[model samples]
Target: MSFIARTSLALSAPNRIVETAGRSLAYRRFGTGPDLVLCVRLRGTMDSWDPLFLDVLARHFTVTVFDYSGLGLSTGTASYGKREMARDVDDLVSALGLTRVIIGGWSLGGFAAQTFAALHPHKVSHVLAIGTMPPGPMLKPPEPLFLETATKLSNTVADEYILFFEPDSAASRALGDASMARIAARTEPRDHPTPPEVFLRSLQASIEPSGPFPDPDDAYARFYRNTDIPVLALSGDHDIMFPVENWYALNDLWPTLFVVTLPDSGHGPQHQYPEMSAEIIASFVRHTAAR
Candidate 1:
């Protein structure tokens, strides 16, 4: 099957690093316009993102993706906690001298993005969360299937389909295959995968009854409630991990928050609908900035 040819730019972007707080942080930058920094998800490195999605975003913004400290090729202490990971984002932003940026993430990275925007609101121009939940109790806890597939030492394309695509939709599965092919097409040097022990630690932390944000006064919740900065929670209608309904439930409480739901999709809407996802994000940044 033939795939779109636009993924080449993201596939060919070179790996680079910056010194931050005495540690070297691994990253890649491509595209143009304002800075947009994306944090990777649990068990993910910069290499895990779909090239088609990244390339499309590159057309609108100077996209940056990176590895958390001590994970992948970066050197430093690593912790899966959202607050700790937010520090990584902060250090990277400061190290790059980016005065302002659009902060985005997927899954666990979404948790980090939320925390970073809350902790350092001045640095983030907007918040874009893909296939992730907001802080506090979720409308639906993660399904067992996600854990069964996600914790594998290495995932096959089938496992990826289960973890990211809608199992009940044939079209979504076909798109998932195409996205996997686009990711595999990259021949450039890539970041190392997160170790099993590290990812297991994250899984354990997430499954605890308290969840990612145990505090009653979660920073993300408070930030969403009051901040003037626009927050876009992008998700699939049937996500098994972080359900999109959770975001919809809080739409009235957050002042500058919006939700975008894609039907017949699951956890990775950006991968299944790369061009549409990028356009939604670019439009969000553009229209919201005008307000």
Candidate 2:
């Protein structure tokens, strides 16, 4: 829990605490106007999110960002899976009495956000899926690498994973192998790696009976269909995680489904271009709400 709440001089934002999802989830609410839920990537907490980015979002809507259970400060048995996490989002909204929210997510978090909306369409007024894809072999080349890393890192602490998201600072990049060596020293949790059962449960929830979803070739059209709500997908051209090709394929399926790419951005642009990104999604929500 210290990772989510224990603040250092680096943290610039205040927090609003709440007990939801059966945990004392530390949520941060900003933007005094409409409601928006920021579904963070896997194993994230509100604090790990960049405050500068969130502050920008707060300017337009009352954004709700919380820790997913079993990560950071959120407490519970460390059982992991998308269904449970998606359910947590449902529980969070219901507990807060919010009937409508523009649910958005990043990476694995984005996948779950879309799934939550698809499963509970009535609750999600709008959807924004950033840096995600339908599950399958069609995903980016780096996905398999990421899976390998995830399987190896379940017992690791969040700090060790920071380099995956952080930009290559000149000072650090200049150091080359030495830089990664320093980053690698960040420790994994000593308790234990997540058990195979937890991983299996997560996999079952993420993929359908046949395989992973959106089927890349038809993701955009598919995601936009069966619901009248607006949808957007933001990605990066260099995203090795689920490379730009995946999103390009989605766009081909639904040419009208708006999409954007951030220059030099990898998987997390909300942190890199918070205000502009927030504006993009908030505008769509407002437009849809007016309609």
Candidate 3:
């Protein structure tokens, strides 16, 4: 399907639910090629993704987007740790009968994607970590202002702009606005907003530092270093949450790691530059699969 075609479908795609791990997990599937399961960011539902971005990805792959258990339309208790979240993804994938798939995660989802690859390397064909930091001590803490703003129960458009877009650039702000509009386009059957308590729990699980790395060389060598799967890590150069330098440092350690930095973007590079992000992801998936 073409990007436009997929975008249209994604805007109207029905939300599907599957019973996995004794809970009903809400998910959406689009596109028509190899399976690509995308994990949602912290406290975000499947509807949190931008339609334009989803459409671009759906055009080239079978894109699967879903909410974590107990969040959005999904039913069950939520898990805070990345490993537990990864297990939930494994259950969802197995419930769908997908044997081998590429997994992509954004933000906290990126953490889950990395854990999933590390824990279930045989089942995952490749890993795409976007706007994420590597696991362990080497990962930098997010700015205090970003964290404080993000934790607010209700965020205005201006607040969202601070979190997702580069504040100094009007073009980036415009993209952020457009992305929010696309995110809001899915009107009917919308997901239930994540409760404040659940949101806090999940957020804490993701940001709490994983410290006590005795070996300097292995500070960031927990999951990604152990997995042989082809890995692609992308982030905006101006990402305030997880800086682009983190990925560069990661690549320095693991030379095989593929890293891309989108110019002038903040945390949400995919939202800021959907077309470029989609192209990079699609091309990488194709090239890696061929290998």
| Alpha carbon lDDT of each predicted model | 0.87, 0.59, 0.80
Candidate 1: Cα lDDT at 133: 87
Model 3 error, position 219 (Å): 9.7
Q: Name the better of 1 and 2 by TM-score.
A: 1
Best by TM-score: 1
As for candidate 3, its clashing pairs are none
lDDT of 2 by residue, 171-268 (tens): 22233233233323323321122345655455545554433453444443365544566677877555556665766665544433567777655566
Model 3 lDDT, residue 277, Cα:
94
Candidate 1 residue lDDT tens string, 58-85: 9899999999988898988777788878
The TM-score between candidate 1 and the true structure equals 0.94
Model 3 misplaced stretches (Cα beyond 4 Å): 1-7, 205-207, 211-223, 289-291
Better of 1 and 3 by TM-score: 1
Note each model's CA RMSD in angstroms: 2.0, 6.6, 3.1
Task: Report how far off residue 91 is in candidate 1 (Å).
Answer: 0.5
Model 3 residue 266 distance off true place after TM-score fit, in angstroms = 0.4
Cα displacement (angstroms), candidate 1, residue 106, comes to 0.4
Residue 41, model 1, lDDT: 84
Superposed by TM-score, candidate 2 places the C-alpha of residue 230 at a distance from the truth, in angstroms, of 1.1
Displacement of the residue 92 alpha carbon in candidate 3, Å:
0.3
